[model samples]
Target: MLIGIIAISFSSIFIKWSAAPVSVQGMYRLLFTSLLMLPFARPYTGAAAALRARDWLLLLFSGCMLALHFLLWMGSLSYTSVASSTMIMALEPVFIMLGAYIFYKEKTAAAAMLGMAVAIGGVVLIGWGDIGISPDNLKGDLLSIGGTAAVAVHLLVGQKLVIRMPSYLYSLIVFVAAAVVFAVYNLVMGISFFHYPSKEWGIFVLLAVVPTVFGHILFNWLLQYVSATTVSMNILGEPVGASILAFLLLGEQLKVLQWAGGLLVMLGLGVYLYTGRKKTAQSETALPSAS
Candidate 1:
């Protein structure tokens, strides 16, 4: 899970590194990632036979959401600071919590709520420092928020379907579907998919393989051993990791307030994990003895 978090933490950096338009970048990233997984997932044959009509429909919806998430998130980079965008994007777990409660009937504990509040506070601080209330940044922020919401929906839908399919297969289908959506979007927007320089293509390939494939595979693997809440908590580390990387690689700097906000976010996430574990332990103990 830690490695997955770290690998996904590099997503924004790689997205920024690519010179292609947002739609094209998203299309190629998913296309390459799906192609790389074809041998293992075998989506065209065995996996296809395994999936029911409903599963395919759900996967298609999830793929559309994924494509929208990428489009908004990648586009936000042009108009907003990376720090603000990443901090906002980290709120995805919060949206997931809401979705779990509303759609899955999952009980959210008090500690989790508190942690979310603290994390939002941290996000606000980061945004205040990195984002101005200018029209452009506001548009970017709105798009970022929309991207976060789309991903939350994607995960909620994916959690149900993934139980029926192998993680790689699920990812493969979603990526192929998303690639088709992005390809059409790029065409409509007049974006040249093949115009990027070789260096940018190299970065795009790395983005597809590293963050999309390896990161997601590691995350899915961890789900076998850990609670969903635990996985969500771990994902809160992405903004922190991304921010640090942005500073080192992109020469991006944050104010002291922003740094303090990052600390607060981490502290809140720690509290969430601690309290969640305690609750899980208590629940385990509360299970009645069987015959």
Candidate 2:
């Protein structure tokens, strides 16, 4: 999980390094990842065959959400500081919490609700600060939040389906769907695909190998061992790691408001996750024990 966090921490930095259009960059990242996984896909054929048509459709929907996430979050890097963009991404848990309540009939605890409010308030603070700096900054912040929500939906769907399929097989299906979405999007929008410099392609590959392969895949794999809360708390490291990387590599610095907002976000999310987990545990303990 730590390695996964560290690998994903470089995502924004790589996106910053590229000059390709956001859709193009996203397209190639997924495309390269899909290509790299082709050899392993053969092994997962049995798992793939076990999935019904409904499962395939769910995977496709999840992939669409994933594509939306990449497009918005990657696009946000154009207008906002890495600090602000990544901080907004940190709100994924709250979105996921809401998803559980709506889709799975999970009851949210009061403290968790408070935490969600505080966390969103913090992002709102950051967005307000960005508006003072530049409207474009606010635009980037909104895009980042949208990306967060999209990814939460993707995860919610995955939570149900991963039980029935191999993680790599599920990932390959989603990646292929996402890559196809980007391909069609770019083609319709008349964006160039093969014209990027070697540097751009290199960043694309790093995005594929680092964040996609090592980061997210490892997280999916680790879920078999750790509680979801443990995994989520570790993910909070990304904003800090990404911010530090941006400062060192890109020389991006945060303002007082940014720092304050980020602290609130981290604290609120920490409280939200742990409190919710506690409530879940208390309920589980009260119920009849499983034999």
Candidate 3:
């Protein structure tokens, strides 16, 4: 999880370093990631073939959501401060938990809802502050929130499918599907495919190998071993790490209101996770003891 958070922290820095179009960065990151996963996923071909028709549909849907997430998120980095963009992502687990409760009928905690409200208040503070500064800042904040929602949808579907398929196969299908979406978007928008310089290509590959492969893919694999609560809490490191990295590397700094809003976002989500973890612990204790 340490490696995963560090890798993900670099995601914004890489996008900030890039010269390519936002969607291109997303396209090639997933494109190269799919290539890297091909060999491992190939071994699971038999498992893939046996999946039901509905499974294929689910994969496509997940891919679309993942593609939207990357596009919106990378685009946000283009227009907003890294602190604001990454802090808004703190809502991801909240959205995912809410989606599960609404769709899968999963049990949830009222504390989680209260925490989400507080966290959202934090986002509203950021948005309100940004509105007075520039339209683009607000634009970036909205984009980040949209990206968060899109990814929650992707992971919600992914959590269900990863339990059924090998991690490599599931990841490959979703990554490739996302890459295809990027390809179509770029083509329709007349974004160049092979026109980028080697430096940009290198950045794309780094994005693929580091964050996509090591960060997000690693989390996907870990879901098989640990509770999602563990993963969610550990991922809170991204906003802090990314903000610090942005300061050190990109010289990006947040103002007073932004800092206060970021704090509320973290505190609210921390309460949400702590409440959920406590509930999970009690549920496990009462279930049974192994003989």
**Which candidate comes out best when scored by TM-score?**
1
**By TM-score, is 1 or 3 better?**
1
Q: Which ten residues in a row have the lowest lDDT in candidate 3?
A: 124-133
| lDDT (10s digit) by residue, model 2, range 113-181 | 787677666655553444435789879978988998898888778777777787788788899999999
Q: Each model's TM-score, in the order given?
A: 0.91, 0.84, 0.85
The best-first sequence of candidates by TM-score reads 1, 3, 2
In candidate 3, list every pair of residues with a backbone clash.
none
Candidate 2 ranges beyond 4 A from true positions:
108-133, 222-234, 256-290
Alpha carbon lDDT of each predicted model: 0.81, 0.80, 0.81
Model 3 C-alpha lDDT per residue in residues 7-46, reported as the tens digit of each score: 9989999999998999999999999999888876657989
lDDT of 3 at 191: 92
> Which digits, one per residue and each the tens of the lDDT, describe model 1 over residues 6-59?
898898899888777888878988999988887875444776797899998999
Off by over 4 Å in 3: 110-132, 225-233, 254-285, 289-291
